[model samples]
Target chain A: MSSFRVVLGFELKEYFRSKGFMITTFLIAIIAVVGLSIPRFIDLGFNRSEEGSSSREFVTDNSRVIIYDRMGYLPPDELLQAYSNFQYAGSEKEVEEAVSEGSADKGFVITGPTSFKSYIYNADMFADEGAQIGRLLSYGKARKYASENNIDFEQFKQTLNPEISSESVILGKDTRGNYWYCYALVIIIFMMIIMYGQMIATSVTSEKSNRSVEVLVTTTNPNSLLFGKVIAGAIASLFQMSVILCAAVLTYRVNREAWGGLLDMFLNIPLRVLGIFLLFGLFGYLFYAFIYGAIGALVSRTEDISRSASGVMMVIMVVYFATLFQLSNPDGIVIKVLSFLPISSYSAMFARVALGTVTLVEVIVSFAVLLISVFLAGFLAAKIYRMGTLRYGNPIKLGVALKTIRRAKKQAKKLAKEQAKEGIETANEDREER
Target chain B: MLLEVKDLVKSFGDTEVLHGISFSAESGTALGLLGRNGAGKTTTIRILMDVFRADSGEITLDGNPFSAGDHWIGYLPEERGLYPKKKVCEQMVYLARLRGIHKTKAMENVDYWLDRLEISEYKNEKLEKLSKGNQQKVQLAATLVANPEIVILDEPFSGLDPVNAQLLKDVLNEMIAEGKIVIFSSHQMPLVEEFCDDIVILNHGDVVVSGRLKDIKKEYGENRLILSSDNYSMPELRKVLESQMSDIVKIDKEKKNFFVLEQKPKVTRERILGRLLNSSVKIEKFGVFEPSLSDIFVAKAGDEYE
Candidate 1:
């Protein structure tokens, strides 16, 4: 086997043998399974009894509502449409007394046709009982007006609230339908990059701090060690993410009917969009992981990792927030520009593919650019890793390391040119002698 | 097989560490690389192992250019370490596999080295759980698990008890007997002198002394004699020698048991002995002096001692 394979195998074994890794993966998967299966065990009230209905009757037992229609605009039967149990009170004082005495859950006094007074023993932040009573009073006034004019009440109601039958056919991407999953995928990629990037950096720094890097560098090339470590980290994180996501997706698919398709926008993802997400996400992760690995080698202690990798972390954070904010406007100029850049393209391009229009040529070019950046980052990381292996003290600056590599490259070119000139001269001498 | 390094020049940025130093080691023999701290020994070894490219140099195996990747080189670095949280056998096999050994063969090699080093029972234990001496043994096992053709040991005898040191000595002797080129680096001169046939002493990145151990000792020991008298103490012997042999020899060193004398120019050991016998001090021990490796090292590299 090649050295890269050997290193990769060893790193993978380390991750597999870690208890923290195994428990975290298993626990997240369980959480996903349970979270997706919640609708089956409890009624979330997303199911409607009849199709094309505007509202459903409140089904709570022992829940009472007291109403005092001062203007007599709302009928008790019409108020009953908003709540199943309604107590008609002659005075506002009676309505307030019933609510305060805990005999009623809520009380509404219609002081005017469009306005009302509400009373409750305890107010809930999400309660809309007053609004419901106001709507009912308005409808009752419309009915009373129709009766006085000798118009058909049903025809008047139909004229006021007409139902139009329409079907929405999306010719392009459905942003509303695909929004949740795209948001979820963007967060997933961002989290993977941060978590696994730190892991790769920590691994490298620990090896350096413990002095194991000396033996490692001698046993295998730095390129093999770095690339193997990064790839192994990526695979480990990808495995965990796949398990959790698959658990949620499969459980929801099995229970889609039980959920009444409520979570379809978040869980039912298109395979093509998912494919783009995987490809771009993997490349972006590798790009950052290589840089993290190089930063790891620059530090001599594990404590220095955070300080050294802060720059990369900042860039990742910027990309994460930018992609989230651009989800609603995937085809805007900002996202269009970011989609082609390797740093933000992992999420920006995926967002465009899911919710916005994108051409195949644009995707191909963006992917190619990202792939090349990954390779470049890997090569640079390997060089820096090799240079920083034996050095131990304060952490080396990234700028200084880059300068050194550039200078070395220039020196190597000069040396090669000198050697070529010497070879030519030696050949000329030999020819003349012959 | 012969491994030769010639004109190795290495620099780190503005400061040059190794300045065109050269040495050679052959199969079935051990070469001792002696140097004080910061004497560029590790730097040179790293260059030979391809950890760092030399600014300019020629390294060869037999007659062809040498690439460290093409050969299995067991390097026990001075800064010794393995994965502290990993099982001993697991990491040993990993290191061996990195050197191109297959899994089955790697496992076999790890078992063999662990058994040979008497740490077979601890093979499944984490490295951090082992005692320091046992950890050093595991490190040695890691170095030799690939059955490398060349073995480079830096301070291998450190942190070892007499018994463990003897075990390591026996293993090294066996490696040399099997015709493996062993480059032993240590500050413990006695251990190097015990097994090394050749030595190169580096001081400030310069080779101060390089040759066969026998020849270097012979060259340093010439015209020097050790004498001890039973009738008098070293001070008394020194006094007598100053009075009677002042014309023939000069007292170089005075110890509690013996006195070392340097002969005058063109003087012989026999002449010094004749002069010592004629003195009133009774002769107890008299012989031509053979310098120890430590003595030679101090003589050559002592000026820059911190």
Candidate 2:
């Protein structure tokens, strides 16, 4: 047990001291700080736009509108009621001169009873309050026509537009916003596995190529060495993730009001759902860590690390892509089946649960499968590691490595049994002599 | 006996690397594991250290079963290395701690070994920064950091200069004095001759010549004689040696000025000396020659050693 601790301690020290680890952690921290502060910057920009719109509202409300009744189809009091804070102009030329002199924000010239043209400082204003005034006058004309024809005004308005509303309900208390956070977490897990898993493999291969493993194995159990390295890699990755997560949470907390309901949605993920994320996150990492360690052991040189780890990398890719595809169709039969698979369950089942498309029993079952697979992978990896550490030169295939491990284990057991039997025979002979 | 390996049989795939090889060493002595290249010396040492399983073997320590990990056995493999990027003192402490030494004790041991190896200045230096000879010394220090009871070294003197090699020799001597079982394999015959009390010469995974170094040398009878004279020219010495000897098994004088004659079976050293004197060869030096370990190795391994 102390040997185990020693291995773990030194491996972690090596990891922390490595340049790659430090550089990657620093890069992630920078990205996290930058990622978290983006929303605040965006909110500032948003508030600036809101302030600009509010000032525009004050200008449009207080500014005057002048009317030139050239056709004489408009009455003065009704026109005044139609356009508040209006000034009567003597001619169209006067209205234009007032607009040019900036006395009015807009000008109205009554060409006929139902048609008019306006002079404005900007074309964008034409679509603004001017368009609203046109619609309102048109409605007034329609209502007058309806009243004269003995038609119901309310019925006429209802004919133009009808009332409609929409609402959605899932099986459980989950929002579309929850899916966003779940998916982000899944992507985080994927990226971490790739970064740290490769680190573990590279580290093991470095030790092998450096020939330090020869001395290391003689001092401690090879299994302990493998586990120590894998766990150390895991801890290092988790530490980086936690740093980034804390940065994100801190940034969000400082600007909670600006983030609004989106931040609340992420923060309000049920405790149960968070529990599932933790379970699958930890177990899934362990599973991949074991496989990566085994691959590292099978390869003799650091140059072969990537090529050897690619097979396991491909498996992880499959799981990640399946989870991504399943997120789109959480209720599909294929996705439901994949959710139960140990390989895909880590992300797939978690996504389903986050989307409120899975039951409690399914989560429990899938989690069990994932946990069991982690243990089995750890077992096989330890065996391959023990057998592979001593065998050097060229990368070995997994099949051949497993076979060699089994053979070596059998041979060791036989040797032990023979030694035990010889011991018993010697003891019996001594008894007979006595 | 502190350690014994009896009839160890090891095979890799279908090829038998060691067939029933056995050797034992007691405390307070160094056992020289001698062999030509690919003579199963490493295989034997690896089995003794339990790096690999022997197909058939029973090793005992103090008349009980022995397991490598369960014992305080220090090993320096033929392919020696330390973590090149790791600090020397840190690596030593880590390895020592793995061997179950307390942290404080391990650090003390590391400091002592670094000082002993005259590498205290390199305690904080990365291994790659050191010269090759210094790196080798650091490896040696790491091997002894745990203060193991039995030290197995494979080719410990391979890459060392004379000074460093002598340093290691002195350390091996100290280990033996402390009642540690020291077994090491080396091709440097003179070093083995200098320090080894017993020797095991393996040939093709078989122990062809083994036992106490002096006893093995004695077993190869001293039948050869060298005659040196200050006055004798090459031709005159040849004539004198030819006339004075009968049943001369072999004569090799063209190689040098002195006459080295291997007498026939049952020939006594005194008889050869008397014959040379009776002929008045005016001998300046006369001695019976004992075969060196290399000669015995060549004789035993034959063309393989050649």
Candidate 3:
């Protein structure tokens, strides 16, 4: 086991020093950083477009200025300034020239002698992007009603419209930035967890393909070596994730205003979710890595890595779909089952935590199930790995693999029995010889 | 007391691959394990190396059952493997590191072996870029880089040219000369006869023959003799030899000699040698022949090659 640790560290160092490893890490990290930063740059440009909110208002409607004066919504000085921007022009081209030549952002038109609808509906009036044109036509209709019935605009406001207010309540503890943050965290965790699990698989595959396991297995128990591999993979993943996270956190903090409340979400989430992620990450590693180890053992060449890894990868893809379904309907049967199952649990449980949907008791129960499943999978995988490592020329069949395990168990039992019998017989023989 | 494999029984699924096989090798002795394909030579090697577990057996070392967590044995499996994408020295050093050797010392050993094999130029070159023979040398170096005390190699001469094979043969000889316990498997019987003193030949998952190679070959006691005379064609001598001996099992007029095999029970070599010594049949040369390992295997295993 200790020797395995040494080998693992050597493996990590080898990858870390490799141009491939360094180059890959560098590329991914740079992409992640640039991906985060590019949005801020684009958002900055968008914010510049919204800077018009600070533009000084030029009241473009002459009638609106008079109404504003009566309503006291504007002061006398402001009302007088509104008359300068709002005016009746002879032709529509003059109105367009006024708006388009940086004189105003909007313009108002007043009807002459006909009904207000005819004047407002004319193509000549400059109405805001689209809705402003409809509002101008509707204003003409309201003005006719005001003139014929002797009703004022203030009375219209009082009798015709009621202010509506909305108050939406959240039932559960709200983690700030729940969706975006949750998604980022989930995606990062998901992608990286897959990567680490595959790392274990590929490493084991390489060893088996190269027949290096023959030398290692000669002196060490397979279990100890596997334990070492599992631990190494987890550590490697965590180490890499932490480095990238640190870089991201540092970068985001530099753009604090845009990413404000980012740390708030981290602080508010229950410490229990962290525990869930770790527990889930662990089982995920074992469940996925052991199966990979088994596949790797069966392969005699690098080409076999592709074929065998796909089988394991299919299971992962299914788990991914299960996670997505869990995200959509967390309490559904499929989602519930996957949440409690070892491999799917990592994905589903993380999603549930992000959604603030899972209970502590549920998490504990799911974890318990996961732990047991991991042990079982590990044991089975070990048997398969042991058998697969020695087999070549043809893929070892499932039936053959099961029988091999059974035969080994039976052989072990028989061997123990014979040892016991020999012990007694040797004792008796020793007495007789003595 | 160096190594012991007692009643090693293994089966692949329902079929037995090695049935209660047993053999031992003392320290400094090279034991040749002989078998054709699918005869469980690789299985036996794997079982001994702990890559495969025996159905029923115990492997002990120096009077104690070997603990499973000790990385002290060096094993070269039947498949020759190294990272083809890696440099020769780098791959060798990495393999050595796996066996608990420090990088610096491993590098030194890598340099030593590369120079010894006269392939030092390939040290900094990727193994894939090298020729097949060079790749084999890299694999050979990986096997001994850790300098293990117990070495088990399976089919170590699979892809080597004759010269490269001799180079590896010399390395194995050197390892044995250093008081190491060596066990190897090969179908090249002559090399086995030259390098390994003792052997165990398996056929159809059973040990058909196991002993000192010379003694095992000697056990098949039908002595062979070859002779030729300028005065007589091989066919003419065959007729006369048939008259001289009743135990003639096989007769062949090969390119260089007239060969004859006689069963020991029916006629003694002393009688034949006397006939040759006294006869005026102008003899070119006559000599007794030793049975080969292949002949011993054929006699013991018969047609059950698998």
Top-DockQ candidate index: 2
Model 3 chain B: weakest 10-residue lDDT segment is B246-255
For every model shown, what is its TM-score relative to the native structure?
0.91, 0.82, 0.75
Model 3 lDDT tens row, A253-350: 56545443334454344566666666686677667767665665556665656666776678777877667645656556777778777777876776
Q: What is the lDDT of residue B66 in candidate 2?
A: 88
- lDDT string, candidate 2, A50-152, tens digits: 4444333122233588878665655443455455688879999999999889999788787765888789867673356556456545666777778999999
Better of 1 and 3 by lDDT: 1
Per-residue lDDT tens digits for candidate 2, residues B65-128, read 8888887888999878778988999999999999889999999999999999999999999999
Would you list the clashing residue pairs of candidate 2?
Answer: none
Chain B TM-score in each of the candidates: 0.95, 0.91, 0.88
Best by lDDT: 1
Please give the range of 10 consecutive residues that has the lowest summed lDDT in model 2 chain B.
B246-255
Q: Quick one: ranking by lDDT, best first? A: 1, 2, 3
DockQ of each: 0.66, 0.69, 0.39
Taking every candidate in turn, the Cα RMSD to the unseen true structure, in Å, is 3.3, 7.5, 7.3
Candidate 3 backbone collisions, by pair: A60-A86, A219-B68
Best by TM-score: 1
Question: What is the two-chain DockQ of model 2?
Answer: 0.69
Interface RMSD of each: 1.9, 1.2, 2.8
* Model 1 Cα lDDT, one tens digit per residue, B106-157: 9999989999999999999999999999999999999999999999988899
